[model samples]
Target: MGAATTRATRGRRGLPWLVVGLWVVLLAVAAPFAARLGDVQRDRATDYLPASADSTQVAELQDRLPGGETTELVLVYHRADGLTAADRATAAGQVAAVAHRHTLTGTPRGVPSADGTTLVYPVGSNEPGTDEKKRDAFVADVRRLAHGEGGLTVRAGGPAALATDASGVYASLGGPLLYTTVGVVAVLLVLIYRSPLLWLVPLTVAGLSDFLARAAAYGLNQAFGTTVSGQSAGIMTILVFGAGTDYALLLVARYREELRRHELPHDAMRAALRGCGPAVLASSGTVAAGLLCLLAADLNSSRGMGPLGTVGVLCALAAMLTLLPALLVLLGRRVFWPLVPAHGSTPVARRSLFAAMGSSAGRRPLTVLATGAALLGALALGTLSLPGTLKQLDTFVDRPDSVTAMETVAAAYPERSAQPIEVLTPAARADAALTAVRDTRGVADARRGRTGGGWTEITVTASAPPQSAAETATIEALRHRLPGSHVGGPSAQQLDLRDTDARDRTVVVPLVLLSVLLILAALLRSLVAPLVLVAAVVAVWGAALGLGGLVFGPLFGFHGTDPGLALLSFVFLVALGVDYGIFLMHRMREESLRGSEPAEAALTALRTTGGVIASAGLVLAATFAVLTNMGLVPLVELGFVIAAGVLLDTFLVRTYLVTSASVALGRRVWWPGRLSRAPSAAPRRVPEPVA
Candidate 1:
């Protein structure tokens, strides 16, 4: 008997090392592919467009044109007071130099403003083809030549230049975003654990999970031609750390409790896995399932993000469940030193924060519930204050040279559009298309530009400034008049994006709700409990968006909201917020199963799980908050809203509203499940078993 026991102990001890070794090998194989993920990431507007949109068709046709898509730019030279001969001469000399150096499409001519304060040159080139890198390089070379001298300000602005600026921001996100996220997670972990060694285990495991996710994403991209955008990729990284760390916190908390009763680290870990495994699995599944619904979206960016984000969540789940547990067991009880839970020891009794909260909630459940609901409703009204859909110029938090140039042109050329609307037509109908374009109302001028691939390109300048209502009206007229021709440009793309986002919301929202509710029902085995969680998360999402409206314009000085903001925020908040609900509710169910009274079960569950859930929430919120530092307005908005939503759900909704509602409902909360049946006359406290 003694020999058999010794053999069993040895086998359990060796298991963790074997698992760790396997992970090391897996990572080694994945490292090379993961390193190249950033190379394939694309942030171009056309990359995100719906496949059937006119703008997308134009972009595709342009690739087969004579120039393989034109790289266009406007060189703006300005002086506040007025332009002198020297400034004009300097501008002319620079334009000539640029034309000589690059393969410019036509001889450049400067068009002076009526006020004589600004000079603009429209430059176009097809030499760089459709290669983004080459196009960016060409734009950069042109920018270098167009420089400010003394009073004259020289800037480059156009579709190509703006793309270069946005890409630069996206490219910078890879290194800085990763480093900042890691630093934030590390500091939070240190504070939460307070044990120097204990924090490293989960952090390391999460890092590995992130790397694995990247490799898998890259494979998906290469194998299935999945569109991987900068926005989607960044969000994936955030989830790996934020959601991954959350699962780790819950498991560690349970393991610590198990350690107090179990004699060995291996036994404690096994028991811990059994205790919290279902909840962890269910939570991760809910997140994964919710994200997958995005595949229904018409927007390529949103659709592609679905699978990639799911990969991140699943990888994190795998690592935390397997690798994290193995590491914790291998390190032994000493890993949690300075506050170790020794074998055979019972936890010290104290008045926990959750207990106090539960008491208040139990006393006046309806009142607490009403107040929370009211607050959320009031906050949701703030959505009305949110600005209109964000424009290209206002897309960045920090204005780049391209945005400044475009703004200057818009101010200077109020009567004429600085941006051209591109129309592609069949070569045989080129003359008819040109005639229709000229006859169209609101067109300042229409001219044939390029011919290739059996198609003719016509550039039409609207009488109104770029993106103005008049210009949009003119675009609609052209599309309506010329049925076979495609109308596109930066302005047209934005219009398509907004329309597609509206369509996506109608389709994806209900699917997400259905998916999450089903997962919760299966896990909790109750209809009311699932509905409560779903309803709470839905309220949280609305309130969060409403909060964005209140601050986005007034406090942050943002001019407009991203088109996809509401839908994306709803998906993230509801899916991620339900994570905490699962933790608390699973505990409450366990207590009820052990024969605790309804009110007692709710309070006890909160007391045991509250601290861990709060800590996890803080980590997740802090990690997402890092996105606020990004230069892109969409990223900043997304980060702020999600972070704020998580905090609100954690400290307010989950802690107060959920607890109170559960207490008020009691066993009825679990109606249709066995737990809903009448309880025994006396409560029974199940004794802890020895391992």
Candidate 2:
């Protein structure tokens, strides 16, 4: 039946082939347009925060309060001997001259460090609304002034400087990262398949996935006003490469297996699809759904990444099911060139090591279960002490202009350079709220203004930098002090992050688990199996997190643990982990239906499916581990955690969890439906050895 289906598919492959080509062309047409959507905002951190009272009430409150653009150009003067008073005066004069000439806003105030090694000139923007281009012009003018009358080695470092630096870093890193990912995946394919033709299949499929993903993103952005930034682009690349290749491998491996069954080439392709397609689709669907959960995230960047990653995975699935099979039919028999076919032989019995491991695991399920649990528990201890910092300056390897400017501003005018905190008060109580915030701990100063009718805005400067835990705590405390007034700013953004992290920890895990359990139940048609599978997955997930915390927290200097990592780890472990469980359990059920005793069926299933599981796990683990090469700590931690989680799920969880559950349940494993008990009249031939 499978053979006939494949042959029929081959006869009608032209339509799918055309569809694949059309997708390719569409993607190509959209590529350039997609590439131009860059992060257009300066101070993206500020943008990520909720609208502050000052910004919301700017029009009505403009006249009564100090300008919102309180910050002027920050000046840094340095010499080998440290800045002298004369150098400070000279730098201040230069800053004042530039500010006066440009008629920049706010009084030009000179601030020098206590050590006298740094000085800052705050030249405020001229009007309430200075466009970015005008600010850029002002920055350029300041640079020229600071560098005039002999090379004083003065450099512009502030919000403007940081924006310039971050842009350069993005430009330098973006193209190279994309090229390197492609190059690495290409080289790996060549090494693994050893056939240029076969290698190109995965590369082509990956490219197609990328194109579709981008087009989908463009469509989504156009409709929803959501944009994908350069940072998210890297994530899209990885999702396509790792997931697309994994799906391709499943199809190719199954195709080879069917070929060994003496099936005709076209028939074998269809047979492979029939056997593997369901699993691949299930895996991709779970992953895409898991990623899509990021839409609930408060951060726009994170929320965008969720859909972008999902679209990529979905495209990869489409390519695997439609495009890849068609391509395989076109390249029939030549897919595994230079390797002679091994005819009429089941490859399973010939592998002594795998047979031994399977037999041992099947026999001593308790020992295997206990050992795996212990290993995972040890690793999970690390997660308890995970840090939660997301400061860019702390994370980036090289100081970008923004970070340098921040450091300079910190050194020169610690009090004045503080990020603004906006407090909103009811018009009736505006004066009281402003006075309360001004006296709050860590607040350097505060000023208030009534916008109109029922609201007032108070701008407060903190003694501490925004986004710090201390700053967040201070903001929360101030909010409490004001009673009814709302506090929002960079500090509020931090508060939001803290709240999001808490919600993810408490909510996302349970939701993901429930989703995975529901998926397993539907796939297996057995509540008992899904329950055990989800439990085992949770164990593996905890262990992976605990282990990652130990490795990343204590050994590495990265104190800020990425909040997104936990959610990502949970999704991968549950979704991908369940895949292996399904493969093994499905074979076990088939064996049982053929009249083998539960124990024998379990052994047979393990011997047959264990090798494929291990191989797939290694490929996936390696693919995820490659993310470390991106030189980003978050990526590195994500790579390590995900790879470790998958490894645990594959080796420990699948082997012990599924096998033990099968043993313990025996006939009851298929309870409520008794689906595993379907009898076959024909004698089962010691399970024709796995190839």
Candidate 3:
């Protein structure tokens, strides 16, 4: 098979300048169209979440109600001494006057808190159109006027203001992260390769892959009508760089090894492609397959992420096979300048940490395996305390605009400031149902609005945040207690999100496992090997989740689990963790076929493949660790867990569990029609080393 692959590569040796030219032409044609797609989505948020869901109600309520476009500014007026009624009334009148003169719609709807310390104004926008910039300007103007006037500390926050704040944070954090990641990759490559010319190779390939991915994603969006965001753009960057570098390392490492094997430069290149190419292709396929499975998720954001990530991985694979090889072929030996040319004299003969670790694990497989399992089990204990809340406000660290606005509304008008949960009763008993709901548990107030004909809108304002579990339970109770009514509101929406995410996890995990198992089985032609690898991966996943829970629960006070955690964790663990296992098992099979006993083959495979796995792990982990600096908690947690998972897989599972399992299974590892007959155990003279 290796010889056949070598022959296939040897058949094509010329520089493929035409391919490069075509790539250039494609990019040139796609860039403008891609930019236009982004613009269309940016112009219409409703295109993502259509307000047609409320179109009828919005039109009916348009005349009698205060306009919903107003951004509420919470002005907390505090005095060192207790506030007099005169002071309260004076502040309210002043607020109303300013609001009236500024063309702020309606009067300042002032509601003083129970303690009379804080006053809230539910102000609406005078402008008819809902322009975000105008709303922002109004908030800024309100803030400027309120400052130091009445010894008041005016904290203006709402959806618009919070989004503005988030944008600022993203802007501030994004530049440094980009520079840092690029600089780190550049410096690391230069240091490792020790050649300035060679250091630029991966970055160039990465940039091209990124360009292709963006262009492809743009095309996909147009074809499928998907919306991509700046957030997804960040994810795309990490995926391209991480996956591209991994593929490049595999090819480069193999190329160097082949060159050392006394093969001519061109032969070595081809040989490297033959040996490493299939493994690289297989690894990339698994990643792409895993990412594409995200399409099963109900959320548009999750669904969008699937193809975006898949495009990045596929682009990386394409660049690796085509662009990277072309560049290497053009540069030839110059790619490894200044380093004495390496000769392949028994690649695993030299003593190193990986060799030593592999020898130990091979000698004491049981002890090593048992210890690793125990440690992972200890970490898994943290999963017991995992919370199941999906509060968007919790994503913010402190005093983010959305949270502050929510708090302000809660303080000012406890009854009106809270978001309502709609309880839809049957039209036949709509009036009777409304009376029952008003008396239901946790209901602060209830109002029934007729939407013409027979349909009625029963709005139940809860005394808690719409996303709180208590609110969730309250909504559920209302559904059960008022069994005749249809319950749908912010609370109902939260329930829907929770249920959908749960369903996605249940469905996607098995699909990812099955896909990985089938890929492994096809590659190894051994049912047992794939099943063992899958089991090891599942153990690794459980350990990762447990460790993640410990870190997030204790350190960050993240009591409530983000609903996305389980699904994201499963994907990362299965996709990334399986790579190390594949590398180990592939080499084990190769060594086993080379006339070594199962245990000896396990040791040899471990020694030969461990360094590659570790190096790949470090490179991948470092790239993922960059996510920690993105100012998003989910990304931070993901970065940590994924980085840790890769490290664990390389050092523990692949090195220990896989080796032990292979040794224990013996020749049976190739059960159900052996792919290759095991070599006879006969002593043979060692041939002179190549070169």
Compared with the true structure, all predictions reach lDDT values of 0.90, 0.66, 0.67
**lDDT of predicted model 1:** 0.90
Ranking the candidates on TM-score from highest down gives 1, 3, 2
Q: For model 1, state the Cα shift of residue 633 in Å.
A: 0.4
Q: Which candidate is the best by TM-score?
A: 1
Question: Residue 407 error for model 1, in Å?
Answer: 0.9
Error of 2 at 648 (Å): 2.5
All candidates: TM-score: 0.97, 0.84, 0.84
Kindly report which residue pairs in candidate 1 clash with one another.
Answer: none
Task: Order the candidate numbers by lDDT, best to worst.
Answer: 1, 3, 2
The digit string of per-residue lDDT tens for model 3 on 1-691 reads 9999877666555445655667688779867765553343322112222222222223233322344333434455544344567667666766765675577645666666776666655555545345545655666666665543455445555444554555444444435655666776777677667776887987888877877787788888878966575455566667788778878877887777777775456677778888878888888888888888887775555667788888888988898887887777667776778763555545434465666776777777777778878887887787776655746555554446446656656655554435556665556787888888877777778887443344555767776666666777777778778764566543465466566667778888888888898898888889898888888877877787787777776786664665666787678678877777777788777766667777777777777677667777777777777876665566667677777777777778887778877766777777763634555575232322111
Residue 190 CA displacement from its true place in model 3, Å: 3.5
**Ten contiguous residues minimizing lDDT sum, candidate 1:** 682-691
Winner by lDDT between candidate 2 and candidate 1? 1
Q: For residue 158, what is the lDDT in candidate 1?
A: 91
Candidate 2 positional error at 323, Å: 1.3
Q: How many residue pairs clash in each candidate?
A: 0, 13, 2
